[model samples]
Target: MPHRTYLTTPIYYASGAPHIGHAYTTILADALARFARQSGDDVLFLTGTDEHGPKIEEEAARRGVEPIELCDEMAARFRSAWERLDIGFDRFIRTTEDEHKAVVRAFVQRLHDRGHLYAGSYEGWYCVHEERYWTEKDLGPDNTCPDCGRPVRRIEEENWFFRMSTFQDALVAHIRDHPDWIVPEVRRNEVLGFLEKPLGDLSISRPRSRVQWGIPLPFDDDHVIYVWVDALVNYLTASGAVDPSLGPEAPGFEDPTGSWWPADLHIMGKDILTTHAVYWPTLLMGAGVPLPRHLLAHGWWVVGETKMSKSLGNVIDPLQLQEQYGTDAVRWYLLREMPTGSDASYTPERFLVRYEELANVLGNLAQRALSMIVRYRDGVVPEGDAGGLDDAVSTTLDAVAAALGDYRLHAALAAAMDLAREANGYVEAREPWAQAKDPARAGDLDDTLATLARVLGVLAALFHPVCPERSAELARRLGLSGVQTLQEARTDAPGGRTVERGDPLFPRVDV
Candidate 1:
């Protein structure tokens, strides 16, 4: 049965231009969305920029531009980058949008009405860079912000607070009940370890006098919503679960099944795991909303064992890489090189290795099979059985589905690569060139050529999720309109169509 699969990537903080880190999460979600669609599921893939925060205000002042002006520019850069990299997100949501503001206001108001919110005061160390409050214990040595290694300032302010602590027991119970709610096992245990201590109420508002570039609290005009509060509601806003025009007693307010709420999966880097797994879920509970089905905290892309950071000047701009090696190559390298949910290093040498795998194995197979069909059989695919390779294709298709079901994307690509290798080995064993030289071997040659053509067609479908463009080119060369689904590929096994040989799908790249 086809079902809706709602997936999301964290709305990137719009304080700087996007880098490889940003590309990884969006591309990962894009590949998953593509696979779901090919498998006949309804998918809503959401990604965008988080534009409200003190960080944005500070960055704008340094650049001598209004916060909104800076947001407009940065958001465009992110959108442009995703376009170049073929990120097919269904909705590019911006917190600055009026619709998003309406949803945020309504959500906070619901919390306030239910007594989940209260007036509070706080005096603590605040990290303007992270837009978060940090206790002394969380601060690093020399009193730096633990997350970013930046200086913190002492602030005493009146604010609105959500009754997050009130739900701590329930949250822990839910986590314990659903052990797989947070993925990668290690992250789940991390959140559980944090829960071993007390959970405090979340400070959900800041004074407008201190941070003016945010949504003003719906219940209090003197204060504005905390950036995380406004930012986290983006998932709810895009899910169509909150109707700003309706009151708290509305039917849809209680039952959000009609919309895409309770997202199937939320994808983000490990740095923001607490925001999604803890703060976001408790916030939803307070608003009488259901929590997302799953949370995935993937590791970072590092350089020399250090997380790539713009401050260190180690950030890799994906668009620049795309300019040299097409978008699919960049996508392939990121998805194939990184083990899903684990840190992977970024190096030119490793990238070329993956590229050559494409060039020498998958790309080589396409070149050989299609060119031979054009050369040996007058440009038409010969009709025959899949030449004893039927089991290989079936096994690969099952492996891809199983791996993707577990969100093990690297494993899925590995399965497909193995199939490509198997096809190459089959080519060596059959040796159609020798078969074509003898009159008595005509039947054997037809079966060999048919088998290669069939495998190439299947490979096109298997690789479509990770490398859509390259797969489409291969499908076109196989005389198909475009890449097909697993079902379509299994049944169509290239035969009786004119095949065209084109340039290699992935030409070898030199360092």
Candidate 2:
């Protein structure tokens, strides 16, 4: 049976504009999803908008529009951006959707009935910008929000709280027991360190008068489900797995039919690690549903020398990038630039550096080989033995598989680029163009072209996850319609099919 894989990006907050941070997280999740699918997994990729809470209500009121209207507009922007980026997401959930609200209600009610929830009055520093309450120790000396460095207003209210403290020990043990539960040793350590500290009970609901644009609680109409609770439940609702009426075996959440319980991974920006790594798992555990297999938190995308934020007037609109460079170019740059769980700078220079890799390296290699094939062999793919090219292809495939196994996306991409470099070296050394000029060297020329085609075929398959459109085109030109997985890439065996030369895979961008 194919391995079952389910992954998600945190449903983005719809309060502010869609920035590059949102794009980066969503794109990364898309790439990982595509990789799993190409690797022969049954994958579900989920992303969506978090359209509940004070921020949305405030923003909508400010804009003189209904909350749903505001959500609709912003959600469309997000969808358009993802579409332009060629993100092949399986589901795009919205927190305001009835399906999602129903699931959130059901899940929260289960937790409440099971004694995991309680009504309480609270008073503390509340970051209205973040819609989260913080204790005195968490606030900066300036009394600014620790999260975004903005001023926070003090607020007092009665709210429903989740028993987050009860799961501290269990969560720590789980993290220790399953080291892969949170990706990259650094992030895992961060979560464990957090667990070492005392965990306060989580506020799980907001009074409706305070935040009128959210899902109302099943038992308490006067209060709505917390935005975190409503948003996090999306991963479950988006799966299309729940019957809404059927309750699973309390502890196991068993889906013998494999209908999407127990997510394989959730990919999000590092800022929300605690929410995902801590609250999400405990929430599931409290409700007797199995925890997700992994939570992968990736770093931020900052502009030159500083983090990109709307307030800073330095946010890079992803659409502008897509308009300047094509979709595949932007997608390739994003995936190839960032090391797993590490911050990456998105400056013009850095963008060009990645563009060069596409235009000067992979694209250049593809154009040269195909053009030469057409000129010499009349576009018929030449035949050769499992020469050095096979070893190179095998080595490259192994490297990509190994790198991706540890969630090293940058390393996986680097391995593919290395394969391109090896192919370029082989072509330069052999001088297949010179060999084509001599009648006696005809056999050598054919073998050399054949070797190039084989290597290129493997690359096309290998890069299918990162650059699907270009890779699929290359595969077709190389006569590899059926080759999809890395395993298939190794044995593509190009020989008899007719090849065609096309325009450049990636054109040079005018800087």
TM-score of 1: 0.98
Q: Global lDDT for candidate 1?
A: 0.90
Choose the strongest candidate by TM-score.
1
Backbone clash pairs for candidate 1 read none
Cα RMSD for candidates in order: 1.2, 1.9
lDDT of 1 at 60: 95
Instruction: Give TM per candidate.
Output: 0.98, 0.96
- Which residue runs does candidate 2 get wrong by more than 4 Å? 246-257, 480-483
Candidate 1 residues lying further than 4 Å off, grouped into runs, are none
lDDT by residue (1-511, candidate 1, tens digit) is 5799999999999997888888999999999999999989999999999999899999999999999999999999999999999989999999999988988888888899999999989999999988999998898988899988999999999999998998898899999999889988899999999999999999999999899999999889999999998999999889987777775554545688789988999999998999998899999889888889999889999986777887889888888889999999999999999999989999988888988999999999999988898889999988877545888988998998888877889999999999999999998998989998998998888889888887888889889888999999999988888888888877675669899998888987767
Scanning candidate 1 in windows of ten residues, the lowest lDDT window is 245-254
